[model samples]
Target: MDGNRVATLVGFAATLVVLAGLVWVVGIDDTLAALTTADPVALAAVAGIALCWLVSWGLALWTVLRALGSPVSPHIAILVFVAAVFSNNVTPFGQAGGEPLSALLISTAADTEYETGLAAIASVDTVHFLPSVGYAIVGFTFVAAGAVQLTRNLAFAAAAVAVLALGIPVAAVLGWQHRYRIEAAVIRGFTPVVTTVARVVPRWSPPSAASIEARIERFFAAIDRIATDRRTVIQTFGLSAFGWACLAASLWTSLYAVGAPVPAEVVLLVVPVGSIASVVPLPGGSGAIETVLVTLLVSTAPVSAPVATSAVLIHRVGSYLLPTLVGGGVATALGVDHAASPET
Candidate 1:
């Protein structure tokens, strides 16, 4: 096999090993016991929370697509969203895998170029990032309100600082069209290591300077199209924020079901922190997500080691594994090729 294929197989094997370690660490029996002993009413409540999460995500995607002038029906958009979610889970590039799947699905449905669909998808991603800042803002507010505690560890503090630093560009892009003018200035802020790696395998196409400028113009024009309707913009942001809140609630409910007594706000903080840690381009966030979640829970919450471990495992099973299985089945039934899909 080719080197790339061999590397992919190695990565997949590593992912499996990580997942296996998680299962062992969490204790399969204890996890099963937690599930079996969970209160029926609590289980029902968790189910309700999951339903709300699905609806909120669908609404967020629908709002962004509509804002981008590709007015898909709500039902279709929800299906596409679910399929995208599934695609992201099975792919190796973390969340980046889902964007192209979303683009392809929408393009096929709308009978348009993949680029137009991608523009819409990119717009959705831009809108999605805005409300994450809202989460950080809300999380920090809770910390200040004594609803959650901030960690003193230098690493945690550094992560919080990094998250804030990353948010700057996202905020600038969402808030101002002229933010591109500052691209060079912002690019200069990267350290030598980051700058060197960026040059090594740049994510964007290496176009001529003129072509790059034109693409930026196109991106800005697309953003303008979505930004023109103030009401739509507000609604899109609201939906994205609501979706994130529901996701936090889902995590909290999963923990509660697994016998952990974490507060909702603590879940909010932990979820975002774990998410930020798992930003690496690994499939399902692999070991990184589990490590972050378990570590944060041990430090921040009142739960014991076994309980905390079980809770994180259950959360991953519900949020990642289950969705991936369902989404993959749906994609297969729709005649989508896993090997050829952009998400793969």
Candidate 2:
């Protein structure tokens, strides 16, 4: 494998070693005992999280599809949603890979124009971020209230801000706002380089600048078209909030299961703050998530290190691992049957 790929694998392995070391230092027997006797209520909480996750994402998908004038049944929405999830979690750099696959699946199944599907998918992501950003803002208050260690909390908070600030939707919006200038800049900046490269490389040619500019215009136009409907925006944002709340409940219950329950406000604050690490490129945020979660739990709760570690492991099983395996199966069963027509 290439150096970067090798480095990623090494990093992933090192994280696993750290987790195992943590468990060992805390005593394997104690950790096992904690897990074996997990609270029943917490087990039941998984069901609630599953429902909320499916419904929230499904509704978001359905809302965008309807707004794009291509409505599908709930079943189809779930299929597409799971497919997107699988693509995201299983792929390298999932967030980058997931959106395009989701948009492609929507276009193929719902028979919407590709640009429309792209816009809808982008909108759903942007809408979800609206609540996420709000939580981050409110999350800082809890941090200030001594919910977590100041340095670690600030680190995670800054990471979240950086992730959102550098996200594609924000970049797209910025580009859209300066469409003409950006388009001109792109051509002016790249044309001469392309021309010189083409001179040296006889078989190579640059893409048509006019085509590139036109596509940019089309992309923004699709976004603007979706923006005309304020109702859909409200609906998607509401669903996102409910979805996020369910996720927080899942984390709380995980803590409760380990007999290390924190305050509700603590759960609300820590979960989102920890989730900031999910932006890391590792599959399912692997090492990154566990580190953030363990830090948050220890800092925010009245639990021992072992208890916090156990709870974080359990939470990840439900939130990341389970969904990834199940979503992969769902995606496999559905396949990519472009010929299968979507229901009206």
Q: Rate the local accuracy (lDDT) of all candidates.
A: 0.65, 0.71
Candidate 1 residues 1-344, lDDT tens each? 38755755676687778767766776767656766766566656665666576667767668777777677788767666666777666556666766777677666654555666676666666666666665655664564466254466324834664565485566765757556755444444433445466688869434444544555566567667776878777887787778778777767777787677776656766766676644566665666777777776766667765677766766666567666666667666545543455752
TM-score of decoy 2: 0.78
lDDT, residue 335, candidate 2: 50
Report the number of the highest-TM-score candidate.
2
Cα lDDT tens digits for candidate 2, 128-150: 77776666556556655764346
Candidate 2 segments exceeding 4 Å error:
1-29, 146-173, 179-214, 339-344
Residue pairs with backbone overlap in model 1: none
> 149, model 2: CA deviation in Å?
7.8
lDDT of 1 at 167: 58
Output the lDDT of residue 270, model 1.
70
Query: Residue 333 in candidate 2 has what lDDT?
Result: 54
Sliding window of 10 residues with minimal summed lDDT for model 1: 184-193
